[model samples]
Target: MSHTFRRRFAALVLALSLLTLPARALTAQEAGQLLQDYYIDDVSQEVLAQPTIDAMLSALGDHYTTYFTADEYAAFLASMEDVQLTGIGVKMQASENGPVVVEVLAGSPALEAGLQAGDLITAVDGVSTAGLEMGAVSALIQGQEGTQVTITYLRDGVSAACTLTRSSILVAATSAQLLEDHVGLLTCTTFGHDTYAHFTEALDQFPQADRWIVDLRDNGGGLTQAALDTLSVFTGGGIKCYFMDGSAQLSALEAKREQISSAPLIVLTDGGTASASEIFSAGIRDLKAGLVIGGRTYGKGVAQSVLDQYTNPELFDGDAMKITTVRFYTASGSTTDTVGVIPHLLVSPDLAQEVALLLSAAPPSGGTAGYYRLDLNGSWYISQKAALAQPEVFAQLLAAIPPTAALWQGSGDGWNSVQPQQAAADHSIPFQSRLFSDVEGSPYAQSIQRLAVYGVVLGNGQGSYFPKSSLTRAQLAALLAQALNCTVPTGESLFSDVSMDDSYGLAINAIAKMGLVEGVGNGLFRPDDTVTHEQFFTIMGRLAQRVSLTFQISRQGATQEDLDSDRLSRFAPWSRLSVWLLSSSQLDELDQPVSLLWDDVTRIDPTAPISREEAADLLCAVLERTGILPA
Candidate 1:
């Protein structure tokens, strides 16, 4: 028989072999029906020509969504629930010699059989495993409960054998601790079968904490229901999560808020955090139950589901596939796919110190109702204070902030961020006396004029307005505060570089209170430091999100034209800023980052320190795109 035919025949036979009573024999018709009815997207018609339907599923471009053979499918289902594992309870990796045991779980058959870390499995059932893949080795080791499998291995250069009878093992999924100051720290590694149960138990263990720090730092998410159950521990059962094809709701999962902890919540995340982790972090922010810290989260918003094995035994037996059935969203309807939850404040992952510092930094106070605060490290500050529910004195105090300074919002709970519809006037009154001689009649004049009108200019009070001067971090803070309308807070600055009495202190405090920006490095905002194109665009991207003008680029769209730099689509866990910039632009030219004026712009050096005119022009363009100003 031909190779393709042999593969197909084996697949069909395997499918038929796995079926019980009332199950029909496998055929081409069965494969077609399964793919058509359950796949998240259309299956290739070329599936019939391939060796097996598994090949078609593999072409779907998602490695996590694929066909699992009978053995693998059984293991997968067992892991999803509290189903038993019929193995030695040791995790391992394939090596040149054999499989190296990483860890032998305590009380597992492996541990009972005296398996130790660094032990190498040389063979299974007397078959040499030198070149066998780890999965194949695993399959050989696992069997029906009470069955005996002879495991041959090498320990300390010694060869030995152990006949282990497999039994079902329950894998626990979460860990917790009562941190200093009665703060609870709970970390969920995966949203697996036992995660929700373990999480509930962890909460019960640390019931005395005044605040809870949920750590999803390196979690490579699992079950959506697991994410929901965990989040409900904080949100006091409402809508844990839901899916909408478009405007129509497909499913709305409700959970009663268990009121696990009434204290303010904190979540820690990093690049490795994804899927279910992303769901929990986003839901926390959307539901206004907590704040997030650390770097941007991994933006994976798709949901998947495996076909019911019991209901479709003929098709599901010895075969399985996870379909990307729906896109997940936050409770506020925010989609966190390519654009993740940008933490209200970005902090280093050194949890001990960061948690202490965050707790020490008191939130905004003395603000009247209805005003916006400088939030999220100043990456997003309220731009329109008058729109808040506070009194005029509060708005007047915050609105009077120097262009290079910011203040906490004088009103309302400091949760949601606000983007001002109108930029404040006389913001740069500190530099009101300057008259720039370099910017007359230039194409950038119109934008520069409006920027100065709003007091975002970085000019000294002297006769010269040095438009060519490199923009400073302090200047950017003040400008953002003025444009965004962040009100006054007299609290100490979060960064070591600025102080409450310093010239830029209010602005620094203003933005930090709002979680709009963070230190340039090492917890220092570096108020005197110059801004670069990369940093500039990163800031602009956050601003774009605040006004709800952020773009969502499809990965499988019409291929974009090759750009100046080859850095467009290659970004991921490492270079999130690039990804955010490219994905949030409606036009391809934004990636090149050339000036809006097609001409007069030379190389767009992302690392180069930007000039005042350049800053004004770019900010103008962003405002126009966000509809705060005319395009």
Candidate 2:
């Protein structure tokens, strides 16, 4: 008989033998025989696939363990290497007290679900975790995508139940915001694939900001390539990082010449920062691109390469191996392995004092009515203020608006002229008039008018401005760039597939220039894709950095009280952005709550193209309220 036939016969006999054995009497060998009988065949490929099987067997502990063919192995590797993973975005610390949320990535599932740092894990999935090890708690929380897990936690002596859905949580290594006084703040959570893109987007969103704060506190680490990419944003060119495998030194990663922003930068870090985070922080610090703040970082400088076991399941069982093969060194040739990168300034955590500090500085003791402070230069506020300040400026701003709109209208024609207003006997203006009219008397009217006048929304060349078109990713970027008066250099498109004629081309280019968006595999910017609420919040946070930067600049020469009151609180994400932008913002001070107009909220058809009008109105409203635009 042929070898294949013999192997098949052996597998069949083994299966028959297992069927005859009593289930209760089965030994480990018997169970192995049963699995082998039903699952394996002795092909050459299968022989080579044994190591993977061994790894999987070793890794399994009562959970599901299945063998993967070569093709299956490749697919599994892809999923593991994916920048996003299914889990809540949080890092746990095993302390004498309990499992505490040490860090929470911005705009993550955990952050959205209202989880916070200092929150103690009391129970997970209904099991009491009173004395559970941090590793156990982490294992309980991590699971397959789409799975739901319940977590019970204590915050300030109050217990709360949070149900979170597991989705691919992309660890945002970098986030940028334009503060109130044109100061930019970029927060690096940990280095990851999307770090550079997101960082650049933040910078592009507020290119003109005078100063910046790059927050790297508690950023553990990931992907060396991502760390280098982030450093490239600040450095001019060449050798961001190098790898050392023992005494063997490899070529260094060189920075590309694409400079995003050169604003004076301040980086925040703590003892929890490690590995790639150290690489980025140290690089920028060494280059004098930014000043480090907070405490020292967690020193982890080893480079690990993942070896997936899919084809040869028997050799590795079924689990993958991540072997540390290299050690990373800074540009200054310092090893950040055990000796962490220390910050330039040391700001310890003071929850009560910080809250009091922010509250006391709260904008001029305004009325309790929800009021948004405007920063005059931000895209949203700039458009709104310019329309309110000079109606003619609105006309000028409208004139420069790009022709990327899906629908267009002839120049010099007002929207009202094209779409006749239905006579409204009630005090409420007709929807069409409300959308297109540039009359600036009422604040509400001014808010509505500024959005229209900014060319964020145009009348269907036929005169009807559809204020309710579902916002798409492309449309939002375009509107934001227009409002900010952002300039996109004419260069070869970074995306391999996006054409100049594509509607999203300019917006994609602008976002890429600012560093808010990145192309997916092989340089493809999926421009027309609809953005989710989380994605939108991430972008808004980036824009909000400018407002924070502005506050920092305004208080540059001020006293500690002035700095604490005006500078910190004004741009404080805890005080301003999160609280003002997200509903969850009400839960914590950092939860910058955003209140949207009823119409605006309804118009966010999450799956459709976000009309230019919606983007314009939302950006304008946010900027106006944040005090980034002059009220």
Candidate 3:
């Protein structure tokens, strides 16, 4: 409906409901009259037998079709579009005095203005929140962007007022990250206003990756325009969906020409996928651009349009409702309402690891795959040339790879994983440098290079190692965990400050469980905090004990345990070493826990923040002392 028509209709409805009939009482006759005038269902008031509003709606059997009061309507619209309120970024929770700031997002005006979590907002814009609910206070805080909203908050029972300019703050609905085999993993939580733009930017970040994975699992969906815009990224431009409105008027939404990539794609879906996400999945599957994997999606083929009633206060009294007025179908004319689009390949969400493995190793649904490895159980169809051209990675793979690991290639029924014994014979495979470009002349470059090849360290995933930067607690934990080949514990995290879902949780908890490192307190592993030189050395010493390795520079070769032949690094890369603390003469001196306070290596400011190069140098010295590196 046009805006003008909706406004006039709303005014009439409001005026008729309030003035023509006693709406305050909402008698059966008046309710029946309103339903007859505005309800989309076919039931007539004459057939309702003077039924009450609830009875009439119940008889119609359209659960989604209902009435709303002023507050309910406002809440409904807020839930749908979130109202795009301009306010400082702080989520509020109900408190006796007012609303308490439960969270303060980083880089937000609230945080920038020194607002902290747990603050009680007693007033907003000079209006006291003494008798207001959290919702009422939240409404008072919202205003136009660039307008100053003054807030009075109490911390420790001391009140202070601050004025902050409101701005639009949105979390990216789409995120991009590089995964194993250099695949660009892009997951869209929902199609929001800026989701398409964020997705396009994410695609540009991994131009080197040849394949991509689009994870749409658990996405409930969002604006239809966002879905159409996102489809354009993959298809260049195409008819996305056809819509049939209440008046039987049909329209098609075609994507604009702003294609991102045509890479071999794999999509993940689950029961939460609906509406906009369903449209996206249909396009990818129908066009053969990607294979949809995981459980069946949520079927929602109908769209709801707002029934605006803010136009007339006399009739609707500032209340409104929504109706499912449009039915949508995919470009292929497939409508998923009660029956979702069954995946081309049905896979369970719990087997996500296997799905990821297949996408990274198995032949893509259509195109040829480059890198793959067969399991130790002797898989079938073992034939395909490895297309991986990364010399450094290949060399590292050949350095000490397990005997059964093999790379695969080709597509569909022609796929296979092979050991590629011929590639191993090509020793002249130029060793590609993986070090930071600026670290060419740094003395620690070779140390960082070999560690990266061994997968013990990594750059920012954008080719920058930031050699001189301070290593975070998480970074050091990952380094030690990887170096010792520690298997991450699958149980719940031991730290309240970190979650198992985060990248650092497993490594940090693994070392903590091994008694190599202790949390700073309160079950909080501050992963972002800087690692101190003293603390790191102490942890490394404990890791050596946990891993059953003893570093001693007695001018002696590595022991049988340290040089296990089955281990790729069993053979000593160095003949001898002269590290001070590990030297036989000095080893017994700092064996005590308290010795770190006076040890020559860390006697001065033991807790000082350590840089990556310094940490690498220390690691290299340990490696040299333990005969893992050549001197």
lDDT of 3 at 444: 75
* lDDT (10s digit) by residue, model 1, range 51-150: 5556655555455555666667666655544445688788787777879996676578889999987999999899888989888998998888888889
- Model 3, 1-631: lDDT tens per residue? 4434333432222111223443333345655555454443445645467466667667665655666665576564344232344678787778667788966754678988999879999889889999897778877877788888999999998999999998875434566767664678777777766777777887788787766778888877767777888877777787887766545456677888677787767677777888888888877766666666666677676765444334433345445544455667666555655335555444455443235434454334454443344332122121123324444344443332232234454444565544434444543664333445656666777666655543445677655778888989888888776665455788898989978898888988887876767888887888999986656655655433322223322224535443333321321223112222232222444564222112343233545787787677566555433323212
Give the Å error, residue 437, model 3: 59
lDDT of 2 by residue, 313-388 (tens): 2433333333344566667555565445644332342121121111111232323222112221121112222223
What's the CA error at residue 176 for candidate 1, in Å? 1.6
Candidates' C-alpha lDDT:
0.59, 0.51, 0.60
Misplaced by over 4 Å in model 2 are 1-127, 138-190, 202-223, 241-252, 269-275, 294-329, 333-340, 346-631
Better of 2 and 3 by lDDT: 3
Q: For model 1, where is the 10-residue window of minimal lDDT?
A: 7-16
C-alpha RMSD between model 1 and the true structure? 19.2
TM-score rank order: 1, 3, 2
Most accurate candidate by TM-score: 1
TM-score of each: 0.46, 0.35, 0.40
Off by over 4 Å in 1: 1-29, 44-49, 78-171, 246-250, 348-631
Better of 2 and 3 by TM-score: 3
